[model samples]
Structure formats: C-alpha cells, structure tokens
Target: MRKLKIGYIPMFRGTARGDREILERISKELTDLSRTMDFDLKIGSEIVFGYDTAVKAVAEMNSFDPDFTFLGSYGATIGSAMIPMDKLKGLIGLWAVPEWELTGRLPLNAFCGSMINAGMLAKFHTEKHIPFKWFYGYTDDPLFIDRFKVTFQALKAIVALQESRIGLIGPVVDGFDYMLVRESSIYDLYGATVDRHHSVEEVIKRAKDQSEAAVKDELAAILAEGSKTCMVDDEAMNRFARLSLALSDLARDNGLNAISMSCWTNIEFNYGNAPCSAISRLNNKGIIAGCEADIDGAIGMIISRAMADADAATMCDLVSVDRADDSLNIWHCGPAAGCLANKCGVKWDHHFDMGHYEGDEWHGYGVVADLTFKPGDITLSRISTEAKELTAFGATMFDKESYQGCSGWIKDYRMGGKPMTLAELLSVIYNNRVDHHMSFAYGNFESSLIEFANWKGISVAKNTGYVDHMELGTLGK
Candidate 1:
C-alpha cells in the first residue's frame, strides 16, 4: 500500500454551525479514512488565500508539504499555498458549505457558492497546465468517498523520501561517482544524509548466502514463474539464497534503508544468480535496490513515487539526453511488473544472458521490471556536481501496455524553447554546471523538495543564479 501525505481545507461559508464545528465534522471523515485508507492526512492551518483567517490553512499545506491537496472551502488566491507544498498532484476541492436545517436534499448552495475561490484556481493553473483534478459534492456517500479516498490515499502514499538515506555499498564504478550526485547532493538539496558504508564485500557476501528455507522458497517462486529450475548446482542455489537474505538483513541492521552496490566481482566471487534478480525483488518490496551499485538507479527510486506504491521504483539508467526535446531517457534492464503499465497481467520477470562479472566466464539468467516511465508522469532530474546544479524536467505519464524489456525512450524535448538534437543534449550535460550525477523523482516533488531543502538549511534553492531560469524558459529569445 502507498503512504501518501494529504492536505485538508476546512469550510464554513455562511453555515449555521461555526467553522470550527464544520471542520470538526470533516475531521471525523478524515480520521476515519486515515485509519482505513493509505493516505496520510495533515490539516493546512493557513488561511489559504492571503493572510488572516483565524486558521490560516494555506500556511498549513506549506508547512506540511503534502503530496495531494484538499481544498477545504479555501480561496483560490491561495496559489501561494501551491507555492510551498511538495509535488502537489491530485487536487480535490472540498467545499462543505453546510446545507443544514431547512435542507431536505442537495447542498447546491453550499458547494456551488464558492465561485470566486474555485474560479481563480482554474484560471491560474489551467494557463500553466499544472494538471489539477476536482471532486465535488460530498454527502453521506460512503461508497463514493471510499473509492475517492483510495485514489487520494495512494496519492498521499507516494513518497520520494525527502531526506532519505540511501546506502552506497562500496565505491561506484571508478569515474562514475561524478555521474552520481548522491550523498552530498542530498545534503545540499534535501538535507538527506547518505551514510556510505566502507564495505561492499559484506553486502555481497550477505546476498550470496541466504537461509535454506528462503532459498527453497525463492527457487520455488522462480519455478512457479516457469524459470529453468536448474541453471547450476543445488549447493550454489542455496548459497545464493543465503546471501540474498543476509544482504536484506544487513541493510536493515545498518539502517541502510536503500542499498546500491558494485555487484560485479563480489557477486561472482561467491554466488551464481546475478544480483540483478535479487535487487529486482527488493525494489518491489519498497527497499530501493539497484544493481552494479549505481547511483543512476537512485534517480529511479525517487521516480518510483509517481507509481503510487512503495515498490513501484523502476531500475533504470541514463540513456540518451535529447536537448532538442528538453528530455532524457531512463532505460531499464529487466521485465517490470504489470502495475506500472496502463494494462494488466503483464510479466515482470524473464530469463536473460548475464553480463561478464567476477569470475563468471559466461552465464545467463532471468530479470524482470515494468518498462521505465510507462503510463505515469515522467520526472527526469539530474544533480550535476561539477558545478553543483539540481535540475528538473518532466512530462505526463505516456504508455498503455506493459512491454517486457529495457529499451524504451521518452521523446520530443527542447532547451531554449527550441528542438534540440542529440548532440546538443550531450553538450548540455557536458557543458552545463552539474555535479555529473542526477536525482529523479516521478511527477514533480519540487514542493516537498523545497521543504526538504529548507529543512536542511541548504541555500541551493534560495541562492540567486541557482536555477538558470534563462536556460529553462528560453528567456533570451
């Protein structure tokens, strides 16, 4: 289940029962849903418009940094309210303008009466193409509310780990550390402290060995999936099982919530099954796991939030950067689950040829993953360290069926408001002031992101000349 943070607005427009009572009644529903739904709710106490409501609901959303927003009879001028929150997706306007006493039926006046508040939101965001959704007319409709609550709950559950601690097992591929603007970048942008352990061997050994029962169960799972049951000796399978279990346990033990390891030599030195499969399983379990100990996968972990699930992170790589389109491609290496696709019943695992790693002369294996960024909002971000820049670019979720592979692309992007050629895209990455590595978050979590940065007291956002708005908006003509 997804753990989404939600922002709620309380309404009492000309109600016989004061605003406090009105909010109290709504609070009951919010509380009940929090218990039953996956959504995490926070009441934005700011006024939501300008300044001066006794409650100040707008400031509340800003402070809470909610993933989904609940407009509780709030004023639309509160676009500033939108300014301080997180990714801010899935907007639900709640106008419970009290249709009491003389009412025998519809609360038309109660909801319909908030014309000014609603109009501004539509006008402001529509022009910006912010993609805000609306759900009005709440009554004793438990079923409908329940269903809506599920979706919003999922929305709230979407967490990109604003201050997350991703464990880096050993060093990255020689020069690739520059390609991964992880730890320090997190510290600078999100106050996230990455605790890098000095041992990759330990993690590898753990994954290379697991419990006897888990090994059997895993083998059975693969068997159930129709994988060629015996690719090697039974002993090796048991060893691989033990190692996998150990790796999981170690991550938990060290508080290394998410682990990325350099899986070549260490994996081959002990076991046979490519760490790829095991990593895939862990990712699906909500623990950010990436093969080859790559930081690019960290970007994938953040983007997974857009999937509306803890285990929805896609393991991918930075493929081609298309400057003309102002976009980038994140490619995967295995068969992904069906949930990420707009379709259903898709296979998320498959047999494949393993790359040359450790002492393995030549061995092949199976891997699984949902195609990268399919049917979900694509948020491609990079944290270049050379000059230290945290840049963000994105587009809508674009896909229908679940294709089984890692060879897909996001197309048509532009920089300087002009179509960019592939070469130009490369030049941008090379010449642009970035730390070499990047961070990715599905959809856009800039709101919560901002909070994280502020919380860290890192001046990345507040610093002038930080984001090259000129470059992003093509302002120079």
Candidate 2:
C-alpha cells in the first residue's frame, strides 16, 4: 500500500474572533477525523497563519516532502499574508470552507476567499503545467469527503507509477506490433522503466535446479488450492508449479515490482507448458504481471492496483463484441487473477489452441487457469504510446455471466456518456490504436484514471459524439 504525505496549510483573516474561532473548530474537527479514517493521507501537526508562519511552515513541509500540498482557507485574509503557493511542488489543492456554515453575518467570507484563491492557484498551476484539484463545501458535507478520497487515491496511483521498477522479459511477440513500447517514453510519461531480461532461458534453468522436495510442496499447495478443476495431469501441473516458483524467486531477487513475460514459443518449447498459471499466481499475490512482454500492460495493472488499494486486477483481451446486447467479451488464454475468479469457476486447464491438437484437446500443451470473472462493475483501461508519447483512456462498465469458455463479459461499455454502437466503439479503439489487452479491476476507477492521465500530461480519450458526462469537472483544464 502507498502512503500519501500531505502538507496542510490553514489560513484565516487576521486576528478576528469569528474567523479564528471557526478555523480552530474546523481544524480540530479535521484533525480528529484524520485519526479515525482509514485512508493513507498523513497530515502535518500544526497550521500556518500568515507570511511569517507560512515561511516556517513551508520549510517544515519541505522536510516532510509531501506528494500533495493543501492550501486551506476559512475566510479572506490580509493581502500578501497568504502562504507562498509558489514554493509547493507536485499537485496543489485549494479547499474552501462554506461561509454558510456560520449562521450570522459573514465572519469568514470563506466562499469568496476560496474563489479568489482557487482562481489564483489555477493560474499558477496552469503556467507551471502542474497538476491540481480543489473542493468547495462545508467540512461535514459528503461531497467534500468524496472529492478528497478520489483526489488522494488518484494521486497515490500516480506516485506509484512514478516509483515503479518493472522486470521485462523478452520482446513483443512476433507480429504484435501494437504492443511495442520504448523504455525512454515509459520513463518520461509514467516515471517507470524497464529492466530487460533478454532470455527466458535463465528462468527455465533456475526452475530445473529446484529440489524435488520443494517442487513437490509447491505442487501440493496448488492442488490444495483447488487445482483439480484444472483437469491437467499431475506431471504437467508439477512442471508448471516449478516454473511459477522460479519466476517468483527471480522477481524477489531482482526487487521487481512487476513483470512482463514472453510466453509464445520460447518458454513453451523449452518447458512444455505456458506461464499463464504462473502469471495468475503472481497477480493474486499483488504483483502485476503481463503476457507477451507487454510493459505498458503491466504498468496499467500497476496503476489500477494502486488506485484500488491493492485490489486484485487482471489483463484480458477485448476479444469480440456481443452486438445483440451491446456487450463485449473480455477473454485471455487463462491468466485471470485467482483472487478475482468466481467461486468454483476456475479450472486448471490448457490453452485454447492446444485443445485442437491430436488427442490432447484442451487438457494438453500448456497449463492455465480457466476462469469466469466475478460479476461486478469493471473498469477497462489501457496506456498506449504513439510517436513516443504516452496516452491513456478508461471506461467504467459492468461484467455479466460468462458467455462461452472461460471468457468474461463486460456489458454496456460507454465512455464520456451514452452507449456506443459496436461499430462506433471499434472506430474509437482503432483511431486511438490501443492495444488488444487491457487491465480490469472490480470497481469504477474512471475518475482516478482520468485524473492520473491529466497529471501525466495527456487528456483521457473521450467520446466526442456523446454528452461528455464523465464527472471530471475542470480536470486537466
């Protein structure tokens, strides 16, 4: 889990009894509430009052080195006494308390000050091309709390990406041109980079060196976890488990946060089974993994996991469209996260292509876990590079029952607003040149994704034909 450091600066009109009283009350309330809430935001112990106090506070805030700085106001204050907004780095937020919270004549002029400070900060951030968010409401309003939650989570996701170190194995599979990524571009856009392990040979060699006892224990653990539904023979399942342990050892030894493997002919030709089950196990353990050496896909999963607070997420292809019901089939060979699998719906099985071979028939070739994704709201997201520039897009939709095989269904896919016809939807995907694989989590992360994209210097792709009704008011503006 990621912890967010927040530098909270509280401002008020000079020496006035009403302004001071309200600031004390709200500050105390916010401070007390902070201890009770489960969120990861850690705030400063004291508030700054003016230029002198703000100078000292800014130095202290620098020591803390917060990811976000909150400039809060209870009322309008003397000119030039406000905190030095220019000193802050990263995302800057202006929170204005509602003047209406007080019954009598305006003591705080909070709404007016908020508007003034917001405009000024907006101009400053715009000129600096810095990311920022704001909220205007009483301290107790649900709306205020919700906005804070979304913004903080979004910031957390961005910070996670900035700090990620990924282990990439092999290159893009032959002919999957859409999955290509440049390490320089990834570093520039998301602050993530690749540590390429050129061959799967090292992984295979390490797996073969495992002791018989260790391999037996791993296979036993797999079986105990309901591997019987997989239908794969013990010999093949054991080899797959050994490979899974090898990958986990490599990941831990190298201090990798995520991995992208090349599972086409290289690993299968040498090891006799695909790495899907291994990939699934890694994802279930909160380590992001991607197929065909897709660094971008792994990064997308990392972002989703961070925003969802380590919730399980998976990568699947936007395979086919269900035209009749305006739904799309999300399928992958067998790499779905075990944590997200429907109860009793996971089968340890073989790749679909292997099923067509002589006498093997779905129970041969490679070991995989077939799963029908649990029914719930799903966010489909991708990060793609074009001419060395990275861009992102996300859609919030719901998953339905499995349609066929272990495939999952995402119904009513809409972006911006309004449902899109299958043709229109395909057009947007083609126009944007997004990869076939996307990351899916069991909750709506559209807001966080949008904000994160904006912070990274790209506007999330939107439906120009629709109403543009995504609840991202003034985002990326």
The top-ranked prediction according to TM-score is: 2
* Maximum-lDDT candidate: 2
Q: Candidate 2: where are CA atoms >4 Å away? A: 39-51, 78-83, 100-105, 122-126, 228-231, 354-356, 359-364, 385-406, 417-424, 466-477
Colliding residue pairs in candidate 2 = 230-348, 355-362
Please estimate how well model 2 matches the true structure, expressed as its whole-model Cα lDDT: 0.70
- Root-mean-square deviation (CA) per prediction: 10.0, 4.5
106-204: candidate 1 lDDT, tens digit per residue = 432444535544555556455544333444544346533744544442243234444356777766766555555556665564434566774766765
lDDT of each: 0.49, 0.70
| Candidate no. 1 TM-score | 0.53
